[model samples]
Target: MAAPDDSEDQDALYVLTAALLTPARFPAALGDDYPESCAALGLDPYPGGYGLVIGQDSDGARWTVVVDDVSLVAVAIASWDCGMEYDLSPGERTVVSVLPGWPLDLAVAAPGLPAPHDPAPEPEPSRDGSGQDGPTAGTALRLPLAPPDTGTWGPPQRRLGADEIALHWTQWRDRTEAEDAEATGTAKRSEVAKEPEVTQDSEATGTAQGADAPGESSENGSPSPGEISHPGIRRVLGELRAYLHSDTAPPLGRVRSGFAPDGARMLRADGPGWSFVARTDDMAFVLLDEEPGEVLPVGRGSELPPLLKALDAMAVRPA
Candidate 1:
């Protein structure tokens, strides 16, 4: 279909504005100069088919008036925050205008197609018990992760054996115990009374010998197999199970376990398109992917559900 003429679009914008905005609430003039005013405020004017005007009241509060020529049925007047990108609130306003400072971050639909933000009736509840505002099931949420390089990722390997998993659990437990002991020692030292003492030559020699004495042994004794009941570890495992069972679950491979230099147990999922890792002591999950390579930290318990949903949406089939 041929595009509407510029004049026709502008007229529609005016009509939309009149229908939605009351004169008392959004008293602002509109004309060709609307775009120019946006430029004066250090913002880019809405490209063709839209105009904008800023209105300030006696109290110094500001309002942004926006008219979209194309929609013809909707316009928006919203309270303005100088630091924020301008957008309309629901019901009271239906159209959005892009003004300068930042480039317009519009999500344009296909030509002649309605965009996701198109004015519509109130959204209905989703089947998954989440309302329309919540994420849809089966959609992958893009996480912040470093972009994947050109090199090919290797084939998926077998899952970690029971012995390897046990080793990681042992490391994690030993580290936790060591930390507890150090903390207890510190508290005790702080509470002890300081005393002055007279020292003979023999006593001085003994003190020097003690100072030179070997420190405690650097050994991490293993715990029994049944002792892997750390609350944090159990929570992580539970969340992992939920992810695997979800409808949008990614094709997760075996668990790869390692230890950090500080003796923390690091567990990673071998998968395509995305990487998941968590430290036993951290009690949180980190998602990595190609989009921005940003590390997203997902908290435990309640936060895991939404995060797992997002992870499912972002997962892709392996090459």
Candidate 2:
């Protein structure tokens, strides 16, 4: 495959889709020597042939294996966003080690390379409602997956559960509110926002908004002011935001529901992106994404770690 080209715009990063299976259960349609065949292309053998499949748009930017799934269907997805901070560079490799017992999390370990700085601050609103962070239109796009070809699998049409959709919508609402507060210079996002233990600030706000925030609609039951500001398909934006925050380092243990992971590192520098590992029956995943509308479309088969985490988290809960 072609390496990423840094000189190009970040959007140039291509999402290549590969449907791979173990040698033992190799798809007869593909081939018997699929593993060896892929190995010829510099593809490393993931313990289960599950590795990343996406890459940057720069030269020498080979795709680094970051995520894998071994049980039902083993798959890996490598990804990179060219020309940006908090994104994988041409040669730096970021891996998502999801072995059987190991913490199925994501991590980026660069020995001597300079850590990239956060992208220039974007204009936001202040806490006071008078500021600009109110309602604006942002695009809503979906990052395609590999196996279930949308074209063949039919146009992107997976229905999220009501609870799942509600949770994400609530997350986006909170994210929008936090951004609005920041934009208007009204308040700051608490450092402990990621922690499950309720923060004094969040509690205060939650109480003040009482019944108006979680599970409650805006006055007249219309879109809240925050929701109106960040327009476009609501569900897609929520999914993208959550997927980009998967954990990659140690402490990879699954997340403790009702409580945040202690010392769980902030993988993304953006104000609210955070991640933790959670598991579903027979499967485990890392939940990523802390901010809404912050994810970019990587290639097909390559999705945000947070999304995998969400799926795994969903699987683990009792049906």
lDDT of 2 by residue, 121-230 (tens): 23332334664444541232212212222222111111111113223433543454565456444323443244345568768776542223563333223343234333
Candidate 2 colliding pairs, count: 42
After the best TM-score superposition of candidate 1, give how far the Cα of residue 159 lies from its true spot, in angstroms.
Answer: 17
Return the TM-score for each candidate structure: 0.19, 0.19
Q: Candidate 1 overall Cα lDDT vs. reference?
A: 0.34
All candidates: CA RMSD in angstroms? 22.0, 22.4
Q: How does residue 245 of candidate 2 score in lDDT?
A: 57
Indicate the worst ten consecutive residues by lDDT in candidate 1.
23-32
Question: Where does the lowest 10-residue lDDT sum fall in candidate 2?
Answer: 97-106
Q: Model 2: C-alpha RMSD to truth?
A: 22.4
Off by over 4 Å in 2: 1-47, 50-179, 184-310, 314-319
